[model samples]
Target: MIEVRRFKKRFGSKEVHRGVSFHVEQGECLGLIGGSGSGKSVLLRSLIGLEKADSGSIVIEGQDITQMTERELIGIRKKVAYAFQGGALFDSMTVFDNLAYPLREHTDLKESDIKKKIRDLLFEFGLADSENLFPGSLSGGMQKRVGLARAIILNPDTILYDEPTAGLDPFNTRKISEMILRLKAKKKTGILVTHDMPVAFEVCDRIALLVHGNLDIIAKPKEIQQDALHPISIFAHGDIT
Candidate 1:
């Protein structure tokens, strides 16, 4: 489980997140929704210690990470994986190399064990045959799959997805949504940052809508569709409040 209590973040003079708080239960897939610059991404970053919070606390499982030293945070970060926006794959390396990079750096596993893990991950991502291909050679959707394979290579307890379905056609977008559902079934807690309502409704177990640097609502998808508090649902679906 994770908790964000009265979190606040600032950049220069701009306060990105102001007094934001929420909780994600273990094995829960929570969607963070908001328009651009609404602080959804900032919140995700803060939760994983990628971005420091100027005030408030982010506790994961019971550890308050707001004041942890860099060395202390490293161990905590290993259990949290992040799938960045646009599936940021290494353009120079082959898919196999990209996926193997994490295990090489983080774990003391032997070469054979690493190879076996990489093979399994590639197979799971449906890119077993494309392991030798560079990111440039594969299509955008394939690249995204490789990126996801790499992120899960460490088998992190919690995964943070930043715009997982951006820049894809409807077909690829749905594929990623299905992947999110599959990940949830595996008991991986997911924090998805996206503005796509349909994707949220399909994949997320719960949705938290951010408006004006605060969480407007956190409810089940069915409740969100029925409730009238979320302004984005009104504009995105033309539902009367």
Candidate 2:
């Protein structure tokens, strides 16, 4: 569903992604594992058109997002949502409003239908009782779940998850993992950039190890464990530190 070919991105003199190429099939979740500053999240941003590639192409469903104007990218953004690492909720708005903002901005759904949609999402993500709560009042896990609820509030075709499980306790991490699996079961495609190995193993169909501006290995989660590449081996065995 998504293809990135020779994606090269640089910030000033720092080149992050150099000739990086990978693809994520429909109904598959690709786990992106890499060290800090490896530009894993840069790929996620590039997919949704938030980040631009200097000298490559990011083709999603046949259209190259790099060439899309802001107006054209609006349509792509609606189909592909980016779930930020820190939840990125609006502190000024209540959870209900935060989730409602997108529906109101992007669609013409009636107030009644929007209310029902928000209610269902909150309940599905286990935040029914906290709809009136603001991001500040929610726990870290609760905030992340609420953020995710807002993300899929549009039923996007694909999700770009940037460090979804970062900083969570084990219990919350499992909850997030289960949530991703539920989405996968529904046939939603995704690119998950995470350092949490267990979460990656649980939800991804294939894991790609990125290092030195390119993907060093791309294989099934179990196959990644047996890969002989140096970076893949250390990352798989948790010896990167």
Number of the top-ranking candidate, with lDDT as the measure? 2
Query: Candidate 2 at 27: error in angstroms?
Result: 0.8
Residue 79 CA error for candidate 2 (Å)?
0.6
lDDT of 2 by residue, 83-196 (tens): 999899999999999999999999999999999999988888888899898899999998888888889899998988999999999988888888899999989998999998
lDDT of 1 by residue, 84-125 (tens): 886789998988889888889899999899888888877777
Clashing pairs in 2: none
lDDT of 1 at 45: 82
**Position 183, candidate 2: lDDT:** 91
Query: Lowest lDDT 10-mer window, candidate 2?
Result: 224-233
Candidate 1 residue runs with Cα over 4 Å from true position: 228-232, 238-241
Q: What is the clash count for each candidate, in the order shown?
A: 0, 0
**The CA-based lDDT of model 2 is what?**
0.89
